[model samples]
Target: MTEFIPPGTCFLDLPSPFPMKRGGALHGARVAYETWGVLNASRDNAILIVTGLSPDAHAASNAGNREPGWWEPMLGPGKPIDSDRWFVICVNSLGSCKGSTGPASINPQTGHLYRLDFPDLSVEDGADAAAHVVRELGIERLACIIGNSMGGMTALAFLLRHPGLARSHINISGAARALPFSIAIRSLQREAIRLDPNWNHGQYDDERYPESGMRMARKLGVITYRSALEWDGRFGRVRLDSDRAEDDPFGLEFEVESYLEGHARRFVRRYDPNCYLYLSRSMDWFDVGEYCADRAGNPGDTDTRAGLAAIHVEKALAIGVQTDILFPLQQQEEIADGLRAGGAQSEFLPLPSPQGHDAFLVDIARFGPAVAGFLERL
Candidate 1:
């Protein structure tokens, strides 16, 4: 019998010699996760929640605190996820800066931080690791898997890699593969970190961190995650009281610039530059079709339809924002279409919001109903 993991934050040590996709491995791999609600007698009431970049396993309020989590608006007793009816499990990604094992963790072999030495990670690796957690928890199948952005990618990977493990999937603003535009933007973000003098090729001291590069990268990310419409409506070239004449050339006059800077400042303190590099690269390299092709005796094929057809879920839902330039509505539509081609029931819901790629985070009113309806049916 599998061990029953209690509700709250905890760690699951993966079996020894965890092999990675890029031919690298970790000896003492561990995954951090959090759980809510009780597992039913049938062990089929579990819901796996895969988060986007930055969020940890803390998906909602628990015994530790009553404070709202990043997804608090949609997860609660009577909320969309309805913790009272389902057991929700959220795991930190393998290469994250959170409590999970990542670049920030000590290398068991070297007695030092993994830093750049951490093995390359892929979305499939994250999915496999999370699967181990589910198995450890004694769950034979998941009622549904819900993911957003990077989490959405992970959800697809999970379904592809572990056939029939989940009964349903909800992908929110995720893509089968990264587009050139996104790849280009992320490459620039990585460049900013690499060019930082203090970066020292990923060997900088903890005290003298690469703040400038990280801040710039974060600023760029904030711009891409939001829409021009939102900026115009929210900031509208409004000047902050602290704006200085000498800073005009640097574009600090607008309140929007100040907002980005404030967000960057807060992010730099919490995230590690090395972790960002690894995870960003991983997303760029992910291609669900590649995995699907390998499963179908064509290791080098690029048939997207063939790949999506491998999923064995009862139903799937893809949600997208109208202004989501990062992943876009077309990508979500493609997911729905691909799933249908693969012989699964699928639905596509494109929402109109100025919030862009981050709409799912900001516009809960639009997402809560769509997600709740899907889950309730399952």
Candidate 2:
């Protein structure tokens, strides 16, 4: 079992309505999150960083006796998320396995891991849980809510679902809806895990986990999370090794294979395949329009511009990387345009980087300042 205790943090046992999206009922659910800095008496300094899929709430700090966090370069005492100037909190998403309610959580009815028994999750529900966390922190309003990828989707959900929750919003490389092409690709990844024999229909015990299936899923995800240009430049179609192979495909067939192997190994070890499947599925089903309704309730509320104008946020920032094909620059532009059309104070910048969708992590020099500059202005 994964240990629940992380150093210097507290777990908040949050309650959820049983059966969530569809199952039956969960007696209770817990959300494991960590906070840095301190909330002033007025509680106006809180900044929430909702993580992307598959990552836990350990956003900054060396908590959980875990390795340096995924975004440590940009979140520290003097970094972009500056613990010194603002109170920062990161929470595991509602459907995540890391001390949050998900497929791995115990099902009160069956008394086993939810697995396939878990109710389906939606992006709006995920965002609602996040809003609950912020409220639990006694933050009536937020300085900003920042998110990336699926986290960005959740951030949008928060704004759409709760019109005035935050004074500012920052969505990086995300869209209002999942593109059909993206859904098609993610479906293949889920299939890779489901087809694995060792998956045992999500009933496999601890000792008999589906490592190979999980690895395949990670390999497939790595392909979509980044750009083809990145792959070509980083790993051209080179030989397996320095020496020629005697018709041997046993070793690294290309630099891309080696790159994928390292990525696959790490992801499989750190993540749960069931969590991967469920979260990816939730992302595929994500659409802001799903929550909005027309007079007939047939689901065609495409004009987010009016909603943006109605929001009472004081300031906001929207950013995108030039090479982020997964959520291309146009999406960020749309968000910025909507905010401006709504008369909200927001700025949009598209950073030029070769790291593609991963630029938010690798292109720190550019992003670091952008983040800092935005927060500083606020």
Candidate 3:
């Protein structure tokens, strides 16, 4: 069934008022988004549902290409997101091609694809655009802003950039800054794309779409998202396709390789190459403290422990999955600590799962109750 979308919601595409990181301004800076539930008269029942990389505004609805929405399991009537009570909004980030302004869009000046010429996007810009969306929707304040992975980073950025925008935020599997190891991994992925002759420096207008390179990059990303322990337990030494022939390749002759290839193929088909490069680069440059020290623009100064101590909240909960290697438990703990220090009611809970960073999607039984309990108390 098509993911249920509440009635009377509208999609908005607004122009960006600022220049992009790589120079030039977008003429019609479109942001694909969806809204659900009612505004509760006061509009305080709104929840900003931030998305991870690649997915679009169809966070909980059927997409144009018959694709199931990303967070379908968690977003419906009476689900964790509870569309019946809370209004929700999800927008495709600025640099994504999934119905958002990105390299795939036509450049107004040249009337051609932006491609490599598309400017770099930052998480801050994502936050800024989201803030604009909320405002355009006539929501003065958000009850909570929830995000995962890059979406988590954007949520944190929202807290930092627009103080008091969200009463609370739930960030899942993300860090304030991308680690050096992450940088190296993304660099290698970028190399894979650039090395592919078909990429043609992001100028490929062909059908194949650097599939091999994109697949390799997705494989690398999947490896990092999980851990050796999980991979070993799930498919250790398993035969590929249940049997291998003499002509079968050695590396992909294993079940795990096939599994990774499946994920890569899906990712490559759904996501764009230049968008991947720009989004990965945004992650690389996402140090919360980078612009904060100068005070010109604080990207991580939403409310430090000392800063939060002054405010009051009914209740708060922070959750981390044990198998999530991408954003370790330590990062979630740090967020919990910040909330507590800010004097808001808060607690950190860790749940065990084998799904790695994908645990949030797969292990919702545990997460659902935790979030529901916290919300109930509030």
Assess each prediction's global lDDT (C-alpha) against the native.
0.87, 0.76, 0.73
**Tens digit of per-residue lDDT, candidate 1, span 1-378:** 011222456899988799998879987989989878888999999999998888878878877546667788888788899889999898988888777788888899999889889998898889999999999999989999999999988998999888888989999999888888899999999999999998888987768788899999999999989999988999997888974777467667778888999999989868888888999998998887888777778887877666777777889999999899889889899889888887789999999978999898889999999999999888
How many angstroms is residue 140 displaced in model 3 relative to the true structure, after the best TM-score fit?
A: 0.1
Which of the two candidates, 2 or 3, achieves a greater TM-score against the reference? 2
Q: Please write out the lDDT profile of model 2 over residues 43-154, one tens digit for every residue.
A: 8888888878876777766444445677879887888888888888888887787777778778777787788877778776677777878898899887888988889888
Clashes of each: 0, 4, 2
Candidate 3 — which residues are off by over 4 angstroms? 1-10, 21-23, 62-68, 241-243, 248-251, 296-316
Error of 3 at 58 (Å): 1.8
Model 1, runs deviating above 4 Å: 1-8, 243-251, 296-299
Clashing pairs in 3: 308-342, 309-342
Residue-level error in angstroms, candidate 1, position 257: 0.4
lDDT over C-alpha atoms for residue 10 of model 2: 54
- Candidate 1 weakest ten by summed lDDT: 1-10
**Which is the better candidate, 1 or 2, if ranked by TM-score?**
1
Report the number of backbone clashes for model 2. 4
TM-score of 2: 0.90
